[model samples]
Target: MKPVRYTGLTIAWWLVGTPVSAIDVQHSSLVELEAAYAYKTGSWQKQEIVWRPEWVTRFDSGARLTVIGEGRFDAKDKLDPGRPDQPFRAQNTETVFPSDHIDLELREFYLDHYAGDAFVRLGKQQIVWGQADGLRVLDVINPLSYREFILPDVEHRRIPLWSALTEIPLETWTAQLVWIPDATVTESTLPGATYSLIPDPFGEGRLQVNRPDSLADSDFGLKLSTFQRGWDLSLNYLYHTIDDPLIRIDASGQQVLADYNRSHLVGGTASKPFGDLTLRSEVGLESKNRFQDSLTGEIINTEVGSYVIGLDYSGFSDWFISAQFFQTYRFTGTHDNGSSKEQVTVLIRHDAMNNALILEALGIYDLNNKDSLIQLEAEYSVSTNVVLRAGADLFFGDQSGTFGQFQEASRLSTGFTFSF
Candidate 1:
């Protein structure tokens, strides 16, 4: 991989030059140490430490500036091998890798202000949509990172972008608008990484990614939300480039060409609570989704519809239970076997010892491939400023299946976080 250029140094310096006396600055920091062992391979898969620091400067004029930075030291160096290429809008937030095991990044930096009845946030940030926990239906604004597959929390997996967001309150409803100039698509693990998606049968050089670089390729979206009759609802729309690439084989059949395509996403979400149970649902229709035919190796353009229905129950004290069903259907294009896919996810959590100790289990089963992933985790708050965590990830089913293909990657992990 080529070294990504660092173009954010000037912006970083400029932000640092801001006057400190005129603002009320609040600061916090945390250190996290984690390690994972792959039982199948009988080898250490991860040994890393991370430090995150954040600052919020609030001015008397009702304007606020926020900045967050992250540094990581990967002793095993199995997740992120190096700094990937920067996106067009993210050039000012580039990540720097000093060595094979050390990385420094400007995670988020943004300014917030209120203009009359509108709330505006400008700079690099993250925008989240939808109500699903483990599955994505209408939440396509920010791209994702698959370095750890889908095992990590959504907040940790989402890649932030450089964008401008505005929110306006009108009567009983709210409207939000987002303009993202960041051309950063999704970031995938490299070939030799632990969670690489590409097979080793094809050389690493055989896969090529064509990223959009022009300003005209920017992404934009709008959302309208309201609460009425004890129900929360939203209407969402986005015109942007899909993060996942469409794969196609070259003419010589020796190379795989992957490219991003633009699409229009129309979706909505609704949630309602009934006594102890809450029902949530999200649905979206995406236009011009491309998929490759496994038999003929041809790219097929089609409309895709995806939806998720979830039920959450919290009747029992200190116990929480949630289940979700997700599905995706192609209106035109079909795989060699079918045009629809389905998944089910269940999550259970319990808090013990007056909420000091917590235990949780999450299961995701792919109905189409008959594969599944189970995650078991426990967390204990040692003190107000410290917490300890341990977890196990298990995968099952045939090797050709999605989760089953990572069966060998199953692991046990433990970590601790110290906040100050």
Candidate 2:
């Protein structure tokens, strides 16, 4: 791993340049300390704990600063203590233990300035665009870490980028631009051969990943948004390196090489407010995307267009339901396996006990592959600063499909959060 250069220090130094005696402070600060713990059920039980702290400062000049820090402790070991003589297999080992031991992360450190009709933010930050849930269509600025799969909050999994973002108002419309000079791409944390959609090359003792380190691999994004009546619309464009890598087998057919391809995206989004429901939709076109052949080592180049449309209704009591239809179409070459690209996602949530308890369910079903994944969760607020949560992950259907490949990875999980 290479060292990542961030601009948080420079911004913090600039903000602290004011003299102590001449300092013109405006308001007091708010500080919060938080901790969380999660554990899985069954024999190969895995557990983790995290401590996080945050501080917010407001200045008289309409400038605000926020800082957050995190530390994680994992109790799972890579190799089972009882099976000392057995060979280490990627499917049975835990990467979080040895790789992430004593991990300390500066989750967020940013400063925001507002002037007239424009705003500017500097430092390491997460910029989210798009309105859909459980899937990403137009949110292409930041890479994500899926180390713990989908059990963690999506906001926590997003990797922040060191960038400068500016929002300018032009009459009735707003334009936003972001530039990320660091070519850092965080790949999804797939647990070797156990929960991955593809077989693990490491388990077979043949794996190689190639990464781009030059300035040309950086990213740039632009978005223009406006409102009409009760509807919000936006247009987005981004030129960046794909976070997910495509695999290419070597001539020996045993060694697999991973390559991060460069691509561009253009998309549009719309959100409308109905009587008792909210509707959201996104459409995007991706160019120069590459797919590989599993057996022949040939790379297939193709263009893909995908869209998602959904609506959320909260009319009844405390129940909220959301449903989305998502599909992708290829305009170029076809790979070895002729599979369809369509999936349906649904989310349901209910608040009970005067909003202190939440019960939620989410499902993703593949229309073509006939495979599905369902997750159920329940959370209760023990107090103003404490929360308890439990969940279960279930997969069903054919072995060659997406959700079915994780059939053996289902498990019951529980966790708690404390804040003060």
Candidate 3:
């Protein structure tokens, strides 16, 4: 997390409720959070506020070119320096501080050069490609923001990397592709419900964060799909070369060679609607040896391909009820070379209170290890664009055994989400 102070905050909303213009403002605070029992019996709870100003205007040029642009601004805790802090010292797992206040990044600024029913875009924009319940393996491209989560992920921030992607309709099939010259990785949050704090770039040498933002070499992929008998089939493939930082550190400690290869991911997921329930499932296998298959001096084995299987049911959207199960295993596991890890999660969801409340809880098990996890969640909408939420997550079964123990108990948290 960027260096910043956490105290009181200030925000202002310039309302322009015109049919073509919109603006919103909002704020919330949480006073307590939970960590392992040894860290504290509970949390000192932190507070935060965020305000956003948005405006949009659309025009048509002989119905050929559509131009649109939008601007957004964010001000939080030490961001304004006008508010004060709570009486005593507090412990916060939340990363909202003065050093990391949101800069009101651009949401969209592009022109649609439409010729018939298709067009090309040349500017900072969002490109989304995935069909799963947001747990995407094919969504390998796009800028990731480290700020928020929970809402639907329809897009990302404007990127300097221009994309030459398009969709062309065909008789029974369609063709699509996306390419950007300067591959990049925008810092992202690892699900706030799990933790609202930013982790160190390098912690005990975990490989997930160390993976290059840009896959060293440009990344690209292809997808194809078709519909039949209330059934649909789809396939996708992505290729790239990214370094593995942890591998390098480990090899240096002892002496070994490294061979990094271009990674490849080929997968397909399918779904169909059944009365009162939707049957959805996914299966995938991985391979990366084709690009880099050997290791030399200071070995950096950034190569891993895994297999996954998952199933979910959206039996109810009214009251919002859903259930899902997932399991992942790596065929090419490694540790000294690389090790395989497997995990599973059983989730349930509910939406009620005149459609004003949302609830979800998940039970997770690390099949590879004895550690297990439970997450409880709840959210209530105060209005169409305003919401209040609180939830906590608890982990059991000696977690400190890996990080070394202070306490091997829990990691509990709860907070709110609001948009204006």
Best by lDDT: 1
Instruction: List lDDT for all candidates, in order.
Output: 0.84, 0.69, 0.42
**C-alpha RMSD of candidate 1:** 3.0
Supply the TM-score for candidate 3. Answer: 0.62
Give model 2's clash tally: 0
Q: What TM-score goes with each of the models?
A: 0.93, 0.85, 0.62
In candidate 2, position 328 carries an lDDT of 80
lDDT of 3 by residue, 320-355 (tens): 444444454444443333255555657687878876
Model 2 ranges with Cα > 4 A deviation: 1-6, 14-41, 77-101, 190-198, 202-206, 251-254
What digit string (tens of lDDT, one per residue) describes model 1 on residues 228-301? 99999999999999888886767567776778889999999999999999999999999979988888777789
**Residue-level lDDT tens digits of model 2 in 1-420:** 013223565675575445313223333222222222222224443555677777676665557777766666655532121112211111111122224334556666788876567788877788888877857778867766645555456887777766778999988899999887655555443334233333464454455656655356668889999998988999999888776778665656676666778788899899998988999999988887888766565777877788899999999999999999998877764546653388899999999999999999999999888999898989998998788888877877897877776666666777887776
Looking at model 2, which ten-residue stretch has the lowest summed lDDT? 85-94
> Which residue pairs in candidate 1 have backbone atoms (N, alpha carbon, C) closer than 3 angstroms, thus clashing?
none
- lDDT of predicted model 1: 0.84
